[model samples]
Target chain A: MPTDFELTIRPRKGWQAVDFTEAYLYRELFAFLVWRDVKIRYRQTLLGGLWAILQPFIAMLIFSFIFNRLAHVQSDGPPYKLFAYAGLAPWTFFSTSVTQSSNSLLANHQLVSKVYFPRIFIPLGAIGALLLDLLLSLGLFFAMMLYYRWPATVALLWLPLFILVAVLATAGTGLTLSALNVSFRDVKYVVPFLVQMGLFVTPVIYPARYVPARWQVLLGLNPMAGVVIGFRHALLGTPASWAVMGVSIGVSVALFVFGLLIFRRMENRFADII
Target chain B: MKPILEIRELSKQYKLGWQRLRKAQNVRELIADGLTKPLRMLRGNQNHGPAKQEPFTLWALEKVNLDIYEGDIIGIIGRNGAGKSTLLKILSRITSPSNGTVVIRGRLASLLEVGTGFHPELTGKENIFLNGAILGMRRAEIIRRFDEIVAFAEVEKFLDTPVKHYSSGMYVRLAFAVAAHLDPEILVVDEVLAVGDLSFQKKCLGKMGEVSRSGRTVLFVSHNMAAIENLCTRGIVLHQGKLHFDGATKDAIQYYLNSLSTRFGTGHVVDLDGVGDRRSIVAPLLKRLEFFTENEQPLLEGLPTGSKLKIRVHFDLPGPTLSFNVGLGFNNSYGQRVFTAHSMFEPNRSVKESVGPQVFTCEIPSFTLMPGEYSVKVFLELKNREADAIEDAAKISVLESDFYGTGKVPKNGMFVLEHGWYLEQAADAK
Candidate 1:
């Protein structure tokens, strides 16, 4: 038989580029992984996918009581509940993506060690599974807007870009941590701590305007800060923070590049160690 | 004709203590190592210097070369840690090699594990697609063969049921069914046949044979010598991370068997102290195993069929008195357990309240195993718990003998059973 598809295996040198073409070829596998996760995420649970809506919804109610009523935080023109829901939806997506993807490789260690596929799909598929949850939470946010009689504005067009930023940020952190978790194992413990601290640091419970102007750039470096603020500006017609958004996009891209580098460098060692 | 796959000087080196060193340590040890590093450097300890010292390493595979032709069914065999798995892992691209190169001319899918990504919560139908995708099948290809896979697995009634609910046999059948549908130009399988029932195993072997007959290459790694002898046209033996032998299947199997006998000499008393391949969690208690004829003589040449065989197990009991049963299993060269003799199965034969060095003798009245080399497995069980189990503890060869005194030896089956035939006249004939 004549040779049609040839593959050569050899020792890999330092810091290689991600094989985008190969990853693209395995795109169906990526879809299957995502679909599997989504299908089974709530199979035996009593609430099924209602948990996806209830998680952020319940968290929003609690934040509305604690931060709005107890702490007297400003909602920046929208109702405290609406303001909190907008921020909570995106925050949930971002945090869940980070937490889930960080452990994705370890959870699927069998697939990692026993079979050959683009391992990036494990973490990426984890993030992809949460898109449904994000959509559900966003649906509740829009419904809340209807309850408040808030008009749907053209600025809503910017929602997809902010969601993309959140996804990229999650992917960046997820790939790096998942790769590290394979080796260190301590990353598993550290990931929850980091995500917990991140909830407070990101502008989820409070407006970005409340943070001192001097620290706004530092806060924007968190990546999700701009996402939350962007959600408010796009959804509630609040003032846009271009400085924070600019800083966030740069940080998100840099983290993604750095993560891709680390992940690919550690890719070959996963089967040996994991 | 050009070879479909070519490998040159393949090697994989692993650091021995790297995992230990990389493991998270307590803060005190971290501080101590931090404080002593510069002091050790100042004292001129060359061992601590990264440039002067090299971490301990073991080469799992070293400088192996081969050219595999199309339609060739190659069986790879080796003892534990002999690098057969490492070679397969490298070929499967699960792990990268430290050195060497391999050139493949077609799509190669490896089945290092049968159900690589089967989720228990997913339905059987869902897992089929997920497992197929993980094994590198395109979605369209799986869709095209979905009905055939379902029929082959015989799980049409439970296609929508979660895989966790499937019986073990059904699960293995479904997993292997999806794998059998894979139509890669080259297939690499490792011990997947160890699962499923006998009939299913035979069916899988038949499918593999069909695959090879279609002019696709296959690289198989298994410990079952019978399967290798039955299926493979060529065989490769790896010993201590190097290619020990590669030749025709029969010769390769013979060479491997000879190597095993040499490693474990055919002596009367086979010491178990140095045998590391034990499946025991407790301390090593099995000390020695000896085989003898019924007349108290060592059966050096081999045990003849129909003769009585005696096996003695010597063990040490370090703890308080405990009841335990010693069992011996006889497995043929195919790695199939033919029969087992357990002391617990015999009335009033259990050893109770035993401590210190002890010996247990098991006498088989008549060894009816067919003529073949069989490996013995010894296990020490306390009630339902296994205290110690060692496979391949000793080897016994059965020689052909006329058990019926008719000068005819039965060599067609796994065991020789006692039977007699007599001519009978029918009433109509009379």
Candidate 2:
């Protein structure tokens, strides 16, 4: 016999409840959505998953030309190629995931309006698809490290923690922006500008050590700054700043929590507005 | 058994103005309002009740109460803006109410539309699972019923093909098939059957009937009164965001029909009220409508069959009207539109663009309406603007007359056709 559960619906009087259990129950749908996005992303492309590697690779070449060759930007610790690649890997993942996930609600408005599932799944699935690209791009970073004859270090194990930091940061901003996009569609226009501007401020093309010492902590407030620095520290054995990592982690977690709060509150209005 | 679902004082309010702003940033005002709302509430500067202070507020559903029992099939019937869709959306949790509560005793699956989450590039097999999961079916359950669904939709050959390649009919068939197989304590369907052809529609209705007979509750919403009367044990009528009637299907349909009958009465001129507000700044407003005979006599109540008919529509324009269209529809007593005539389609016969206080009259040389009770609906459209329509604006009954000059009246269909019968005798037989 099928199990029965009672449901009561009323006007939302105050702050909304983020039902973790309900989200857990829909884990299968979450997995399916992620899988669907991944499959469809590369389905028609001739290069398929190769585009993932090509994007950051091409960006690395341009950064190497412009920042390293033309401007003579100091690597500060590692070679410019290795330094730029490390930052680009995490940066690409964060930017792509944030941009895609922010538009997830609008892209899947059909499902949002027609069915009842945790609306969080759409953006999360978008992030999940980008995770594949992140992993693939990380492979190129390692190859560049090998070409530079860089030795592996125990710090490599800390890479997953930074990856977690990146995920949290992306999820927070993505979910909040996605919810906002449902109501104020200007988020769609705002996101591209955000990605472009974020690349310059995020220490992707330059190292954190290049910044004046006094402003380093402020740079850490940009969540991607810490993830990029942490990735370089893990992969290239660069100088590590516990203070900056702490600030970056704090900012990412806070952004995530704040985004979640705004997302949950705005979720009920999505179907009506979108 | 106790009722499976109970709804009390359910209402939904919507803001109408912000939706018109085509740009995405316009929603920022609403967000800003929401952000500052709490502080205002704390300071006692906000209105306490569910009072709509905004001029553009629309009460899509208002103070609606309903209860559904197990093994019951309830049909929701209403006009275009009568809140049927809003009620379904609230019930399915697609949107929440502004007040009151709805309680459900068991699992409910709402097929507000078939194939809600279908991806065009996905193969038929994949879409089955995807759509099934979206509709609240478990993977194991969808797998178990996969063969049955494929057979019902008759798409076994295209199982591996992407749905984008399938014809529209095939798509709808497969979508409805997957939706039909969902096993829930209650199912809510909204006009999904209107898409498919006749045979497919019948098949879908049959499937719903089967589901209902298996002791599951069903809530159906449709504009088709015949389908509601045929399948539902109970009927609900909503009018202008309020529950007008709820009872047996027969009585509910009768009540709805009675409401249509009251829209227009036996008079030469019908003044419309309660249609809608004069909201548009540029569009012309329909001021007066009248019916007449060929000799320009005021038509009242009944008109003889085969008599010439004329209709005069008076309009009030704020300024010179530009590229406007007016149309009329005739429906039988059963709430089915028989035929419609529009000025847009007959540009040569249409009225010229002009300013305020203008009357446009349409003449029918031979009115061939069969003897029966009928109603008229008026529609007005301005160039590149949303059309305003008032359904069942006037009611006129066609009286029986010797249209054939043989003291007999044609009693079949909605209208009569002029034709002559020819006969020949064979020479051999003679």
Candidate 3:
């Protein structure tokens, strides 16, 4: 004897279609989380928002001095300051989001252990917070363009698509790291070293032209590779590098699908396992 | 009315070691290990067993099927580790079940914990919204009830202050107020209320009563017999992961008491060594207990209003010492400690020379007892020291007298001694 009104919720696998309504309902929490992250990062700091721009600005000066001066690296005829800053902006956002989001579960151990909500929001919140930092750094990127009397192109409007690809790459990796961080804490220790290695490998300080034309497509599979080349072309009024941006968009979307699916599947085990 | 929550068969399992033993040295190793788990699953074993599988899971709640109707204030009483919290966790959606499923109708809220979802850095008002969301409330509803929540929590002056700075009273007040004002279709609360001050506890219990009367369901877990009897209309007692009783509230409380009395005597279980396995072939050991009149009819069995009784113990000690202390402690049926008497505290040193068969008696001359059962605990201590040699507690015996004097039943708490008072206004008037 059963009532006809019983509503049984069927549990699903990771890649299964998600109920966006649930995530949408929790949007306020997500927004608050994003805002909360923004405030905490800037609060009580003497430099305030300048801290955001300075990280990349100082990195550009160091890279320009070391790579452009000592290593005598070529930057496709543009100033080294613009080259390094262009590459550093998206790279900084990607790396910081990974570090923050990977440790997101550990940082919110209390919330993760005790409450139930969309777990993706924690890593996504990191992305939202890092975006503010990226925006602040962008101002410096423009100031550099003006300082060097570099020309701006309409191609800059297309920067948003490159940014989307960068974010997809970050979100894909961030979600994987955040979910895995709950169980295997080793992800935290490995992130810094990987970020360092990524900078050199992605040609952030040097020009991609040095990487030989045939090998560039395979190199762009790094995702950030495409983001760097695209930012260089967009800001310097150069032609698009189809070989690099094409590989970046492809890799980013792939990572996005793969990361999101694995993350959703593993989110169910979080409360119990963590 | 249909049950607001139904749990068919809920189970949760966990694995303990690999996360600890196999440390990941780098991202390559981490990804390699993560990728391997799914690969193993694809090799035939499914990965759907964590919620369903405990490596050696012994059904925390096996085939547990129940229906909780709307507006029914049901008490969940159980022994420790009796699956009480597990059942609530499954119903609360804190965790999903392994084998069976639970269908919850309407919004289900659980006050299973206090300060849940609270950010230490967030202000009290902000945490209210955060806490409300955690309990399944919408943002608009939280905004509508925000003022009432602050008023109920008594934190009006400190709404902007971060909750990490609040005192225990303030923290609990706000935590409980958020849960109280959620006004969900069902509320499942655990035993966190034992921490608050007495008056606030009474206020919380009163609010729970009001919540019940307003046609909502509540599943309450508490060791307070009086509060459970006062608030819940029904009770479900769990014993070792099985349903012991599911009936009227009074009968359920009685069933719990009877079972406890049978197992642990009327007194609470006292362990002198704080060790569970303490058994020895002794001289005069403190073994078991019962309260009896001179005729020994189990003192609470139907005695006169004002009568004397002797509490007897059956025991022997494996080893004997000179003047090892033996005494008695008393607690009300509700498990509150009332009084204690020991040879160590008084001028008198009553020592049993031979330890084989010892009998101790406390004569209650003109015993003034109310109508409820009273539990007496036995203690053997190092006389005058803050240590026990052997102890057994919560042995119950009834005092069936009209000593409460108002003809009302004795409430489950420390007894209020009847002392007649006279106020003669100074023989007035010259």
Flag the better candidate by DockQ, 2 or 3: 2
lDDT of 3: 0.72
DockQ of each: 0.51, 0.50, 0.18
Once fitted onto the true fold, the runs of candidate 1 whose alpha carbons sit more than 4 angstroms away are A1-3, B18-55, B270-430
Candidate that would win on lDDT: 1
Best candidate per TM-score, number? 2
Assess candidate 2 and give its TM-score to the true structure. 0.82
Question: Model 2 over residues B140-254: C-alpha lDDT tens digits?
Answer: 9999999999999999999999899999999999999999999999899987777777889899988988998898899999877778988999999998789999999999999
User: Which candidate's DockQ is highest?
Assistant: 1
lDDT of 3 by residue, A1-274 (tens): 0123445532333465655876887787787778778866865579888998999889888988988899998778777788889989988988888888989888887677666677788889989889889988998899888999998988898888888888899999999888888767778788888888998899788888888888988898899899888877877865557878898889999998888888887777677777
Tens digits of per-residue lDDT, candidate 1, B379-398, equal: 88754566677777888889
Tens digits of per-residue lDDT, candidate 1, A16-65, equal 98899989888899999999989989999999999999999999999999
Give DockQ: model 2.
0.50
Residue pairs with clashing backbones, model 2: B264-B394
Cα deviation of B191, candidate 1, in Å: 1.1
